[model samples]
Target: MPSPADTLTSDEPVGPQLATPPAISIQDLRIDYGSHLAVDNMSVDIERGVIYGLVGPNGAGKTSTFKALASLLKPTLGKIYLNGHDIVTHQRLAQANIGYMPDMAPVASDLKVWEFLDMFAGAHGLSGKEKSTRIDECIALVDLHSEYHAMCTSLSRGMMQRLVLAKTLLHRPSLLILDEPASGMDIKSRVGLRNILRNICKSHGATVLISSHILPELTEMCDEIGILHKGHLLDSGPVHDVLHRMTGLLPEIKIRLAEPPDMHWKEWLLAQEYVSNILGEDATHFSFHFEGEESDLAELLRRMITQGYLACRVSERQRSLEEILLDLEYDGH
Candidate 1:
């Protein structure tokens, strides 16, 4: 994985976000099939030039919401705007600004990779030299230049994904709505896709709204994420912010003692107001959840080493998405 500094550069634009309308603005969006409600009243605003992830379990309304945003499905109620253009009333303008790629995006079995891209480029109004140059650029962007002339069927599953992604990029749309784009990709291809998406955000200033079942992958790539369950958005924000919002979750603290302490030491540690869920006792190391502020933890650590003379190393960790989501799912039940 790339370091934080490498993946998230300070040079990326952050201010003036509100000066321009959000790349995507969903208002009271709802989708229903007969008596079954697939999506509830979900509202979210995705800023420009950032990757926003939407994740949920099976039948979680992810696809329903995505279709509505892509203008492929008319919501039972609500409005969707892409770059300030209403999807229903100004579809042409809205569609012109977005490229939607669904899971298992198909390709022409008889067409070569470049030919496939060429067709979309022409449809997008490119002509002659411009069309050819765009095809080449998109192919290179996906790292499929090596397979430029190969038959779409001949390409591997991962390569097929790349071909569709290249197709999605032909018009350089400002908003990219990709549903499970990395579904069939291998580890290397997944990494390449992450890098490509980041580059697209940096260079082209495109906002990516992607959905995936893989929670951890989104954690690494997206600037923000929304958790959808049974059509309702449980929470959405930066990873740490969402983590802290979930109940029963706190910053975890691990303590490495200078040596194994007596039984009384456990009681003393439990006496701390902020400490909870202490674990392990057979060794010099132990861990617990801390519900207090950073200053409280620092003071507690100081007291432990100074008064108890048993502490050595103390470190803090944020909970992972898997842990938070599991608690969320359980709580919903």
Candidate 2:
């Protein structure tokens, strides 16, 4: 078996070039199953070397959208472009550039881990020495070296997930679509998967589209995010920009008090004109939601201090991507 470093190098291309183009692009994409329209007019652009998070509640059409992009399910309307080639017309060429791992496990329980990866490498047209080398490279990439010879049935849920990822990388596609890749993983396994995704995006220049209900996990890994709600894309953009837009001009702020405050203080804070909402409150601290001119917030703070409140600490709170998405739903969309 080749060393891990050597295997990594083998999977990367040798030459340098400009304008590699977006790994995947979708425009006004829609998919219908019989009378039900699962995805509705969704559009997105995923550039190379970036991890894009596709997040939504269950049955929000995230899986349907991914299937259309992967060419596993044909769209009822609109177009999909893979590396600038139209998937509708040039499906074979387009598919060659994508590796899709569906939500359900795709592994063959009877096959050994190494054999399964080797099978996909062969399907991608690798032959002889090249095929063997690529299979080894994929196995190493997913850190399945120890379990290479183990039967698929014998591996744990996390190990099986790693094997599926290895299969996806066998073809060395520019785009990877993983639908709930961490579905049944434990905390440690989930973190391990996240690290692998980041490294793949940074080192191999692969664009990854990962859909998950775990908002916090997605926030840490994705460069851009798309939030789908009720089959409509509620918001999609850079994480910080989305948060800023949803909450308007008010900055999220948190304050730590030297001692626990009473409910009276909480009520007073919420009644302030500059404060929009109270995100959370506990014995030691409370977080306030604000929206308005920055100058107005400064005035409110001054008033609080002058009113004889200790106000031991004050800092702008950073909204998580999940918070931003939940806030967007309140706009009556």
Candidate 3:
């Protein structure tokens, strides 16, 4: 299967540019409730056919941004464009291409899965054989074909989430806005949802904008992510790039020796300019922070081997997204 990166670059011609508009663009977006401000001057652009993750803690204005993008809320200040159509003035045209699934969106207990989808399909102006075909296709896309006839209330939380996802896809919307989509999902369900989302972008060229407080989920699933704090966008871009900028790109390096080493090992490691925060687990195990380029790290390993330290294993680990966010919150950023 094609990855989102593959979908982006595959079969495209090399040329000056067609200047294709982004899937969603928000400029100076601000949302307020009476005297309270929710979103403040947030601006971002989502390229087509990518899973863009909106990440923030609660009260970060994620929902307000989604509501404005979905055209369900009027921004106190800002202009939004969906596929080059102004969301404020061209609401119908913009809305016709958006599929929004808010957090905790309810489902009817009396209707069967297919029936629920069928009702939405008709509402989207689909009918007869056309509607039926589209419904079946969406069901299969969300991997709910076997549960097509199951009652809504009989489904598991994961299955119900997929059902709602199928409903969102009924009209084949070009943009998907999902808020906290993995809120109640188990590990298996979350994995399935991730795969399905990747397939959607790869196979259909649909752009997905999903928000979640689950840091590792977004890190693993999103092609790009934006960090929001107190209704402000702190940073946005590729995962590692943003992390590198925010955390100085320092990676913790763990090392293991083939056997117990002489005390000189610690002295030599500390003598290196780029190493810091060195800690030892045992006689032959230790870790430290390496602040250097990739080439420099490789050279340091070679020096270790050349010094007859009998290095057995070396690995690098960056700070997790959760830890980074926690630091941000602690600093009140």
Candidate 1 per-residue lDDT, tens place, 1-333, comes to 223432324454332235688898888999999999999999988889989998877788988988998989999998887877677866676677789999998789999988888888888889999899888888888888789889989999888988899999988888999999998788888998999999999998999999876778888999998888889998988866765665353677888999887777778888988888899855788989888887898898888887665787888766677776676577675
The true-versus-predicted C-alpha distance at residue 306 of model 2, in Å, is 6.2
Listed per candidate, the RMSD to the true structure in angstroms reads 8.0, 7.2, 6.9
Sort by TM-score, top down from the best: 1, 3, 2
User: Which tens-of-lDDT digit does each residue in 53-105 have in candidate 2?
Assistant: 88876677988888888888889998887776677666676776688989876
Which of 1 and 3 is ahead in lDDT? Answer: 3
- The alpha-carbon root-mean-square deviation between model 3 and the true structure, to one decimal in Å, is 6.9
lDDT of each: 0.83, 0.78, 0.85
Backbone clash count for every predicted candidate, in the order shown: 0, 3, 0
Per-residue lDDT tens digits for candidate 3, residues 160-256, read: 8888988998888889999988877888778988998898899889999999877888888999989888889989988877766666457789999
Cα-based TM-score, every candidate: 0.86, 0.80, 0.83
Better model by TM-score: candidate 1 vs candidate 2: 1
TM-score of 1: 0.86
TM-score, cand. 3: 0.83
